[model samples]
Target: MILAAIWACWTSAALGQAVPNHADPSAREILPNPVPVPAIRFLTSADFPPFNFRDETGALVGFNIDLARRICEEVDVPCTVQAWPWEQAADALADNQGDALIAGLALSPENGERFDFSSIYLALPGRFVTQADAARGFDPSALTGARISVRRGSAHEEFLQRYLAHATLAPMDDEIAALEAVKAGEADAYFGDAMRASFWLNDNLACCSFAGEAYFRPELFGKGLAIAVPAGHDTVRHAIDWALVRLKEGGSLDELYLRWFPVGFY
Candidate 1:
């Protein structure tokens, strides 16, 4: 079955849950256009599915691509989006080949030295997926003695160790394996990237579904996803930030989120 059909099968209980909001609602300052650039150039990588990737016809498309266009439209500027190898994207931005990057670039201190980031637009939270029957009444914080499978040495595992210390940790080599442990009843639950798990639940696995609320520990999971401009490019950065806040206030950002993520992660 196609993704849309599969997603349609999701229980209304899950769909009714609130989607997480990243944009600050109070940041409603009217931004004065800083340094009017003729156009905005956006660079992205084509490998990160759902966020940025190529379709069967090989057209550059995905959430990030659409978001870049939206930002330009909101700023009332012409824009162009181009794909590059992940490794080359940062260099391309530094070389002035692009004015901004919409790819899921990690917002690290090291990266902060090289780029100025807009406010976080999305955050990938850690979530627990349990057998469909067991999902009801599931409380992640109370999983004492319950074995929870997670990617070995991942930030998710670290989060488990630090916060959900009551649960027994069953580390696996990769996300699929961790999820398989749960599907096969080797583990009581699986905790990992909510977005990745959502894809598996909607398109691949059917025995399990998300349990409880999404966990957001920015310190452990990194500071979520943001647009990046070369350091000192304050004009571009400010413009992007203004557009993003407007999108959130007008619910355009939420629409894009639901469109890309048919199976809501939160």
Candidate 2:
């Protein structure tokens, strides 16, 4: 992890100078670019909603979608977003199926071995979702045997495991399904991030409450959302990072964050 961090830092320093799309070689060239930022096939999980999800039109939409487009625009590359089931999107990408993955993923130790990660785009702490009666009162112990549902492969899955030792985990394919488990009474509680939980609950599960204070798992949740790439693909990672920097500089991210996570939405 230290090696990756240091590597990322070095790459960032070098990319402080703008890299023109026409100046770089393609991923298949004899002299490989460290990152695969140009004209690439990007992978994502549509079920993550508000971050990356399929709209009613069956077109992919949400924060990651917006962010990825901005990335491609910044690099002058056209991209294809293939929305797959959330459960195995990362594994599918790791097997060399796509150029990148950007589904609001938290940095994990396991991910470091197989993929390079971009700098955090957003800081998202995990929160609990429950009946207004349970969550309004903010009791973690009340979660015991509470058929707790969380999206599989999300950071919350690992967070709840180490932290909610007394609770029973009910894994779901996506956040919408997990929250549905709670709304349907099959699960007493669910775990997710505040910004996303608000959007999901309002649009999918209307009755669940945004409960307790948000929790952090420095060991598991890490700092923010990142784009994942093949390990040692530093050139692609650097280009993506530069794109994120552009969004921050251009105020696009600020507008989106304010719109999506308005104060007290949680």
Maximum-lDDT candidate: 1
Please give, for residues 1-266, the per-residue lDDT of candidate 1 as tens digits: 22231121222333464554565444457473835766899999999999899999999998899899998888889999999999999999999999999898899888888999987788777899999989999987689999999999999999899888888999999999999888899999999999899988886446888998777777777667899999998888878888888887676777788888888887
After TM-score superposition, the amount by which residue 105's alpha carbon in candidate 2 deviates from its true location, in angstroms, is: 3.8
lDDT per residue for candidate 2 within 79-173, as digits (tens), equals 88888787788887888777789886557777777888877666555778886666666788767777889999988988788878888898889
Name the 10 consecutive residues with the lowest summed lDDT in model 2. 17-26
Task: Give residue 208's error in model 2 in angstroms.
Answer: 11
TM-score of each model, paired residue for residue: 0.90, 0.57
- Model 1: runs farther than 4 Å from truth? 1-15, 25-27
Query: Quick one: how many clashes does candidate 1 have?
Result: 0
